[model samples]
Target: MTPHSSAPDLIPGDLPSRWNASTPTADDVPDLHALRSRHEVAAKGRASAGPEDTRSEVAGDGAAARTHVVVRDADGTARGWATAQDRAAGRVLVAVVVDPDLDDDTGDALAGALFAWAERAGVAQAQARGLAATQLDSGAFEPDARQQRRLEAAGYAHVRTWWQMRRPVTADDEAERPTGPGVRIRAVRRESGGMPDAADLVAVHDVLEQAFADHFNHHEETFDEFLARLRADPGHRWDHWWLAELVDDGAAEPVGALVASASLDDDGRTVGSYVDYLGVLRTARGRGVARSLLDAVLTDAAARGRSGVALEVDADSPTGAASLYRSIGFETSYVTQSWHRDVVVG
Candidate 1:
């Protein structure tokens, strides 16, 4: 499924001789955002790439500290881009996007070269942290056959699929919300100046850590990293966060947490609420904790006059999480696949 390019100056790895690669800067946000949108529309038949999203990806900080590179044509037009981040010594996340209008060969070459760069960068990151091994993880559209073939050519294996789910906001969506007895749901506590309370943040992180312990690709993320990541999002707001507590014998325990963010349209308008994370402790399941947390998000979104709610779920989750979302009105919008490659750099 490689793209056919008539260009005669193909390099050893199929990269075109006329193309140049360089690090992206803040000035490239507009162009990069457009490139990402084109790639998204080509891969998923929809455009969700926004300028704010591009800005965050380039300038954000946290556990997954990313570095970006852009590949430009001879005319100085950006034809492709790749970004990489490391969660740990051997665990890395990489993303590659290309101009959909480019020839198949150009697309293949860009992906191939960028993937190689990603592997090398991931190894260097791991070694700098004193690690002995490296793993490069990336994602692609399930519908893009050429991209899949390109990934396979670069030694990556497709491991998981995720469904982007969405539901329209309605006044009746939270009509029957119930947290059951001894359960309470409330926003994360804020200080006098409207700053989030540190204790509440820690509680939310703890609840999430315990909730996702048995989930797929679960990793141990520090509380600081968790906070930094959420704050790094352009749409993040402390008021959009919530915690569900269980009261037992006058002692309150945080059993669940929900993080919501504003989803912006391509024009920068707030269109909906994105359920960034919804987690409930194993011991808190079947007690309406997840339901209550979701209800809070929907109700909050409706109150803010936002369009609806959106989230992604593991398509093959053993807990039947997708079913739960479907029961509450969410439906699959699109599907994406995860690919991984392991490199030994010791």
Candidate 2:
């Protein structure tokens, strides 16, 4: 890790100067929060995360590492910020926010400094493990043409497209309840303290792994990583989880599982339910497991007064999952583009 003072300091007049990039400390929280707020406001109410998410990203589990950079004006007011996380596959995930009004040069310089930090961090980790590869993953909102161009100019190649879809819940929409033989959908059981049991956690992980095995960019996350990552989200709720079991007298374990979480808007109403993961094992596929699990979630969302359910799907998924979501009444609201750069070791 770089020493706090070793990073370059920037001033307002130095519009294109290098900015200090390092791990976020307690003192940097306020500036990071302010930077996030600026970008969120500029995004016109489309941003999904806030300060809490930033805090959690910095405090990641030991397996992963995070770095946050802040650019400040001469008077010490924050002007830009960036965050990058190192995941298991040697890929560095980056999200950056700069003053939208800044000159193009300033924006480019800020982005350059952040990527430099990521490169250094990746190299350091590889050297420690005697490995030779590091990569980067980034996403740009499709509506932001300027950012999209900037990313491409910086040598990132678009690799995948993600669609954000939503469906509004209605009494009529719930009329077509799912019913099939030997299939049962139930709410995830919660303990007295409101925490889910170990079995529930395992089931959800199994379902997600099996469900996404054939999907685009599908990679198996270790059980520990899955639990840590899910629990890290502030929006995670115990009651919002669900499971699907196949009533097979001969089977020793449940056949399928689905995990859904609800997120509320500022008004405290359950505005949407996000299907975090839904899957059925290979042996259980085509037996109505997926539809039944989805119906269970939809029923719960309608009963809770939620306006709709939302999820992201791979635009090029081989399993035709997008069509399934479309069948369930989800409509494409927006698209996000994923850019990937191969890791180069010096």
Candidate 3:
């Protein structure tokens, strides 16, 4: 990790002399929001990052273990931003956003600087954990040519494509409730202390772990880490989580799980629900466990008068997850590409 220094240094390669990198602070939310908006518009012709989204990323997370940096002009105008954090099992998620007003060469150089910072931070995190190798995870919208080039130059490969899908909530859709074969869906059990039951929480984590064991870039995260990450999100709700059980002759345990969070509109109004995870054990895949869980969440959202439900799926998922979502009226809103590389640290 680079030591905290206030001096300005030129980023190697083609960036203009006036642009310098510095650590970011909570006061930069407006600047970060502007950078993200310009990046989104240049890439997708639409703005995706909202003020709340930017604020949460900039201010909500515990700051001790994460790296946040921004690049600004000599006049102190923010031009780019980047964040690096350890997420999942052994993966570091690096996100970079650059203002589109800069020339192509300068923009590319800014991205390279951010990527280099991310790799250094990621390698350090892996070494601290006594791990030899770690995965670097980042993404780009399908249409961002500049970002695609930067990722390629940074030794990241295009690993997978994902589709952001949305389903409209209507009275008719709610009426078509799903009926799984002896499957029961209910909220995660809570203890007397008003916290999620430990055993049930572990069950949910286990189900998800086993379910995605064969999925792309599969990594096993500790149950404690899983719970911590979910609870860290501001939108997390206890009642929004559901467990699926297959009952035969009155014997049952959790066979699947569904987790969701509140989704707000651009204006920060609660508008819908977002499916964070929907996983079923391999042994329970064909028993309609997933369908039951999805229907349960959709029904609950409709009852609350939410606009709809949104979820992301691997476009080429071998489990036919996208097909199932399509059957339930999920339409693709946009696509994103996942880029990855493996870094080894001594």
Candidate 4:
């Protein structure tokens, strides 16, 4: 959810002649999607990424803050892909994947070379912003030992694990959702220009910024940065934003916010809604603000006949969020681990 930085795409060194690497192109999307999808299916028993997702990652305006490389073998067969997205001022999201069928030695070399290129790309972004160091963050499915080995070999440490959870939605969700007196959720107001009301947008940003402050890996992202990044996503929909407020004594105080995106398959069908961020203020705890915001998302998804709502949650959520999600029917579909490596800009 960030714009492409001024960082130039950096290439890996010492790659064998059999593997050709270059910045990805529109024509390269299908091959890249196939490669990653195969890896995803093998790792998670199903694919979570779509071809559009790969297109955005490698090409298009979505690559504005991203630097990516797609590798083709001697016969011009796509075999690997790597990307480093400038997620924030000093944070880069990195991905390095190879064809699941590659020989052990070939996969190791390819992953290493791609990861090295990503670090260079991250360093380039950091250097452009005049930062000393930037974090290279990436993830792998919990069952993907090969990926874990590559990450550890590339100097990344497994820092955290997350639960990718999803819950089916139906007509009954809206009617059966819980309620809290004096607390209600509403859509972000839009102006005539079709843009969200500035005040409402700021309120949503402020509420989320404050709500996640005490949470793990909380980063201080500016409002402008937040909007630009979210709007850059291909799945972003302005109408999917909402805020929960406590209307007391004729005043509505924002207490929670939820930001979701449309989840699409390779064929571009909206299969579900993915909750990108949902947070409730500390003062609003135990008042069901979090649940209410989720209910809003579920209702929206159900109205459109979306199959389900999916979200990623911290395995050890401090607020007992996991249990609440479980009570709402969310089941862990897969597990992913966050691996991180810090790079110093040259």
Best by TM-score: 4
Model 2, 31-148: lDDT tens digits are 6666776666565445565555556565533224555666665445566776666554566676767766667777777666655555566555555546577667777877776667
Best by lDDT: 4
Clashing pairs in 4: 1-229, 3-65, 4-64, 4-65, 5-65
- Residue-pair clashes per prediction, in order, are 2, 1, 0, 5
Alpha carbon deviation, residue 56, candidate 2 (Å): 2.8
lDDT of 3 by residue, 165-229 (tens): 99999897566475698999989988888988888888889989998898988888889778877
TM-score of model number 3: 0.93
Candidate 2 regions exceeding 4 Å error are 1-6, 9-23, 26-31, 40-45, 59-65, 125-131, 173-176, 191-194, 250-253, 266-270
Give the TM-score comparing model 4 with the true structure, all chains together.
0.94
2 or 4, greater by lDDT? 4
In angstroms, the error of model 1 at 104 is 1.4
